[model samples]
Target: MSINYLVLVAYLVVTFLVCGIPFGKIIARARGVDIQKVGSGNIGTTNVAREIGKGAAALTLLLDAGKGALATGLALWFFPAFITGGVSVAPHGDAAGLEGLVTLAAICGHIFSPFLHFHGGKGIAVGVGTLLGFAWPVGLMELAIFLVIAVASKRVSAGSVTVAAILGPVFALIYGPNLGLDLLLELAGLVVVWAHRSNIKKLINGQEKEFSFHKRGDKPEPDDDTIGESK
Candidate 1:
C-alpha cells in the first residue's frame, strides 16, 4: 500500500478520537449538570445554553466545532487538493476521494462517539467545521444558510436541517467531478437529517422549541425534543 494509505488511516483514527470528545457534556458536568438529562438531553451548544449559561454554551460550541475543524485541517494539511485554474478545486481521484472520506470520518466521530458508547451530538457544529476544512468559501456559505433559516424560524434545528440537507449537492457543485466524494457528503448530510428526525417531526407537529432569546430556559418548557445547531 502507498504511504498515503497509512496517512489516511492515521488521520481517520485521530479525527475520530478528538471529535468524539463531547465538550457540551463535559462542560455541563463541570457545572453540576448532566447535559444529557436536560430539556433535550443533547450535549450540543443549545442545550448547554439552556441548562447552564451562554458562556458555557459558547465554550461548548467553540470546542465541538474546533475538534472537527482540527481533524479536517490536519487531514488536508497532509493531503493536497485538485486545483482548477478558474476557481474550482478538490479531489477527482483516489487521494481526493479519500479526503472526502476523511472529512466524513470527522463528522462520524462526533455523532457516534466512542467515549459516549457510540452516541453523540447531531453533527451541526462539527459539520460546520468540516465544511470549513474543505474551504472557507463553502464553510461560510453554509454558515450563512444556517443563520438565515435559524433566525427566521427561531429554531436551531430548522437551520441545521436545511444546511445539512443541502451540504452534499452544494459542496459537489463547488468542488465536484468526484462522484464518490459527492455521494459521501450526501450521505453525511442524510445522517445529520436522520439525527434530527425527531426535531423535524416536532417542527411539523408544532412541538419543536423556539428560542426565547432570554438568559436561560425558554417557552413550552423545552421538551426533550432537541435544541442545537451552529456550533
Candidate 2:
C-alpha cells in the first residue's frame, strides 16, 4: 500500500477514537453522577438533561456533535492527499463520497463506542455534526427539521426517527448521481433507525415519553427506565 493509503487508514482510526469519546460520561462524572446508572441509563442529551441538568446536557450535546464534526473535518483536510495518489476507490473528484464514508464511520463510532464498552448515544447529535461537515446547507436543514418536530411533538424520538428516515432521500436529492455516497448515507440511516427500534415500539404503543423543558416534581414514569436505553 502507498503512503496515502496508510494515511487514510490512520485517519479512520483517529476518527473512531475521536468519535468514541464518552462526553456524556465525562460530564456526568463532573456532576457527581454516573450517566449509565441514571435516567434511561443513556448518555445522550435527553437522558443527561433529565438525570443531571440542562447545562450539562447542552455541554454533552456540543461535545458529542463536535466529535462528528472533528472527524469529518480531519478527513476533509487529509483526504485530498490520498486522492493525489491516483486511487480509484472513490470516483475521481468525488469529495462527497469521501465525506459520506467519514460521516458513516463517525456515526458508527459514536453509536457503538469502544470507550463505553460498545455502547453510546443514538447518533442524532453526531449525525447533525457530520451533516454539517458534509455541507452546511444540509446540516441546517436537518437541524431545522429536528427542532420543529421535537418542539411541536414534544417527543425527541419522533423528531429523531423522522429525520433519520428522510436523510437518505434528502441527501440523494441534494447531492444525487453519486451512487456510492447515497448508498452510504442510506445505510447510515438504516443503522440509525435500527438503533431506535425500542422507540418505535413505544411510539406504537403510546408509551413513549415526551420531553419537558421544565422539571416535574411528580414521580418518574414507569417507562423512564427504558426510554433512552437504545443507545
Candidate 3:
C-alpha cells in the first residue's frame, strides 16, 4: 500500500471524527444540558454560547476551530509525501493544498456531521479555524469581516453569516483552481449560509437579538409590545 493512500485515509478519518464525536461530547458536557434541546436545537457553539455563558462558549468555539486545524495538521505530519505528491505530473501536488482539503473535510463534518444526524452548527468558528490553519491570510480576512459585521449589527449571527459568505471566492482567488480548495470552501460557505436562514429572516424582520458582550448575565430584551401593554 502506498503512503499516499494511507495519508488520504487518515485525513478522512480524522476530519470526520473530530467534528462528530469529540465536539458533541465536549459541548454537551460543558452546558450540562443537551445542546440539541435548546435555542436552534442544534449542538453547535452558538447555541451553547447562548445557553451556557461566554467561558464555556469560548471553549466550544476554540475546540471546534482547533479540531479543524488539528486534523489538517495531523495529515500533514503523518503523510507528507501523499499530501504534497512532490513535483508530479498531476496537479495541486503539495502539502499545503492537501492540508486545505483536510480542512474542508473537517468543516463539512462540523456542519453536516452524519453522527449528529445531519444537524450541526453554522460552521463559522470551525470554518475560520480551518482556513486559518490552511491559509493564514484568508483566515485574518475572515476574522476582520466577522468583527466588522458583529460590531455593526450587534448580532453574532450576522457576523457568522458574512464570514462564511466571504470564504468561497476569497480562497479561490488566493489559491486558484487545480487545488480544489476553493470549491470546498465555497461548499462549506453554502452550508453555513443555509444553516443561518432562520437568523436571516429574523434580521429582516428586525427581530434578531443583539449580543451583549459586556453584560454577561443579561438576557435578551422582551418585545416592546409586551412592555407597553403591561404599562
- Scored by lDDT, model 3 comes in at 0.65
lDDT of 2 by residue, 5-28 (tens): 688777777787788888998988
TM per prediction: 0.85, 0.89, 0.78
C-alpha lDDT of all candidate models, in order: 0.76, 0.77, 0.65
- Candidate 3 stretches greater than 4 Å from native: 1-3, 22-25, 28-31, 83-97, 173-179, 213-231
Model 2 spans with C-alpha error above 4 angstroms: 85-95, 213-230
With candidate 2 superimposed using the best TM-score fit, by how many Å does residue 73's alpha carbon deviate from the native?
Answer: 1.7
* lDDT, residue 174, model 3: 61
Which residue pairs does candidate 3 place in steric collision? 84-94
Per-residue alpha-carbon lDDT of candidate 3 for residues 1-231, written as tens digits (9 for 90 to 100): 677677577768668767654464366566456655544555566556665566767777788888776765566456655444353312144334555567667766776766766556667777787777656778888888899999998898899888887776776666556445566667678777877787787888999877743135554222232111100
After TM-score superposition, what is the CA distance of residue 62 in candidate 3 from its true location, in Å?
1.3
Clashing pairs in 2: none
The reply for model 1, stretches above 4 Å from the true place, is: 80-94, 213-231
Candidate achieving the largest TM-score? 2
